[model samples]
Target chain A: MRLISTYLIGLVFGLGIMISGMANPAKVLNFFDFAGTWDPSLIFVMGGAVTVAFIGYRIVLARPAGTPLMEAKFNIPSNRALDGRLIGGSAVFGIGWGIAGFCPGGALPAVGTLNADVLIFMAALVAGIFAAKALQTLTANRAAKATA
Target chain B: MITEFTPYQSLAGGVLIGTASVLLMLTLGRIMGATGILAGFFRPMSLEDWTWRAALLAGMVTAPVLMLAVSGQMPPIQVPISKTMMIVGGFIVGLGVTFGSGCTSGHGVCGMARLSPRSIAATITFMIFTAATVYVVRHVFGG
Candidate 1:
């Protein structure tokens, strides 16, 4: 039941990315190009998503404490501290997003579009994820060494 | 040099995405964090829970195919860089997603929905850098 529901939702999310022209790299770039030929179109995507989510979450969270909904805690983040990783890593992500106008969600469907370039991008993305894990380990090791 | 901004289409799509996230949360009791799901191999945790991830991924990939089947045309996808540049950009994106803890979906959609301060801060920081990168790449480098 849980898996089926998630799959259905993923289908809708995928369709949304495709229909929103978010699969289009140029359109996404225009959104980020605030100084250049800017396109404010993509902002609406966020607005729509956030509004729905804001309301949907509130209602879901407000469900009775003993209900099935409350049995499984909502997987929302509770951390409030502003940290270096969150900011610095996000800045790095921004540079990448600005470069390609592709994020994980919007970019995935491009593969289904049979976009060869997108496939290449996906390959690199996988490699990068592995690299990130390695980098995280290295940093942690260095920290441990310093403390020792 | 650019196309008309399709406001209605984007908004409708956004609603679909938001609804999808809500549905996932309601049923699975999990946040639909795209990067984490996609980067399955990099999971520092156990991989026993591959059922939902695989199912969701299959649905996501099938989407464009379904669109083609329905309309007999592929969606317009514009690439901003060359093949080599794309590979590099993808790497950056993948790395950043892992280091940053999430991408557009996790941070932008789910996190924002839940009103996490970290997500808000991350979104602002990334938006600044993204806009700046576009400015620098397009204006300074003449791309």
Candidate 2:
């Protein structure tokens, strides 16, 4: 039941991405390009998604188990305080997303479209993720050694 | 801010995404964070833990194919970007998601819906910088 629900959601989400013109990196770039050709369609997409999710989240959270129709605990981020790390990271991330015109969510299911650029983006993204994880681990180890 | 607005299609697609998000939350009790979920798949996990993720990925990968099969056409995706640019951008995104704790779906949709201050801060921070990057890329660098 759990797997089925997740699969169903993913299928629709992928279709939404494709139909909304978001699967195209060019369309994404257009959204970012303010001075040049601008496409504000993504704004509507965001508005619609946010509106529905806002109400849906409330209803789901109101359940005794913290999520409706599920027996598992909610996997929500509890941190509320804004910090330098979050700001700095997000700032840099924006640069990447703008340059590449691909966010993680939009990038994943896009593989189905069988676009070379999407494939390249995904390959590089995987390498980049592992690289980042390694770099963080190295930095932590170095810091620990210094303390020792 | 306004240019080439795709009102109906965008709204319809957006609603679908919202429904997916809500259903995922309600059924799986998980945040629909693409980056985290994908990353978690590569890492080691018990079979029971991995099954749903694999099934979800299968669905995602198959969605466009099914649409194409039924509709007789698929959307075109053209990205005229360099290999170096791809690697660099991907690296930054990976790092950023880790530090920021979420990407579009996680922070923008779900987190904002929950009224999370951190998500709001992250979203605003990314939005400002994305705008700046766009201006510089298109205007200054002519990308």
Candidate 3:
């Protein structure tokens, strides 16, 4: 039942991405092209998403602690750090996003299109993720050696 | 570069996304960040964790079939960049999202909704860089 619920949620999220025109890299790129053919539609998408989520979060959190339907706890991010990795990583992501126009959310649904380009991008994305993980491990081990 | 302003559809889509987020929060008490979810699926800690993630991914990958039924056409997916660029950009994005601990859905939407300072900072940084990169690509390099 939980899996089904999660699948349904994922479906709804993907449909939302597709309907918002975010599934189109060209459309997303146009939003960033302020000096060229600019489209302000992406702003509305963000605004709507943030606004609804803000309100929904309030209502959901208002429920008593440990009252979640299917889980024992609310697995929310508790980190409050504004560190270099966060900022630097975001900068890197932005440059890539500007160049490729496909964020993880946007790209996932587009995978259904079965386009060769999409497939290639997905493959690269998976590779990138694993590479990042490996890099992190290397850095952590280096730091541990230095301390030890 | 030609694109139409689609506020209504975008808003509706955003709402749907928001609804999905809220539903996830309610049921599993989890955050709905696509990259994090995808990443977790790859490096799952347990069978329970892996199953839900797989389910979500299965739904996401098959969503276009739903679109075909509703919209009477496949969702338009246009990659403006070359295959080489796709690999480069995809790699950078994967690394960034992993290090940053979130992407648009995670930081731009859910984190911002929660008024997370880190998320706001990350969002601002990414937004600025993205616009700058676009400026360089479109005007400077003329790509």
The candidate that wins on lDDT is: 3
Superior candidate under DockQ, 1 versus 2: 1
**i-RMSD of all predictions:** 1.7, 2.2, 0.9
Candidate 1, which segments miss by more than 4 Å at Cα?
A65-71, B41-44
Cα lDDT tens digits, model 2, B1-143, are 22346779888878888878888888877777777788888884778667777877878888789888998987666574676787777778888877777888888887777788988988888888887887887789887
CA deviation > 4 Å runs, candidate 2: A65-68, A146-148, B1-4
User: By TM-score, how accurate is candidate 1?
Assistant: 0.93
Worst-scoring 10-residue span by lDDT in model 3 chain A: A64-73
Task: Mark the regions of model 3 whose C-alpha exceeds 4 Å error after superposition.
Answer: none
Model 3 pairs in collision: none
List per-candidate RMSD values in Å: 1.9, 2.2, 1.0
lDDT of 3 by residue, A6-109 (tens): 99998989888988987788989999898999998999889888898999989998897756789888889998989999999999999888888889998988
In order of lDDT, best first, we have 3, 1, 2
Model 1 residue pairs with clashes: none
How do all models score by TM-score?
0.93, 0.93, 0.98
Candidate topping DockQ: 3
| Alpha-carbon local distance difference test for all models | 0.82, 0.79, 0.88
The RMSD (Cα, Å) of candidate 1 is 1.9
Q: Write candidate 2's Cα lDDT for A1-148 as tens digits.
A: 7778778889988877777766766777788787888888888778888899999888887886554575557777767778987888788778888888888888888898777778878887788778777878898999999999
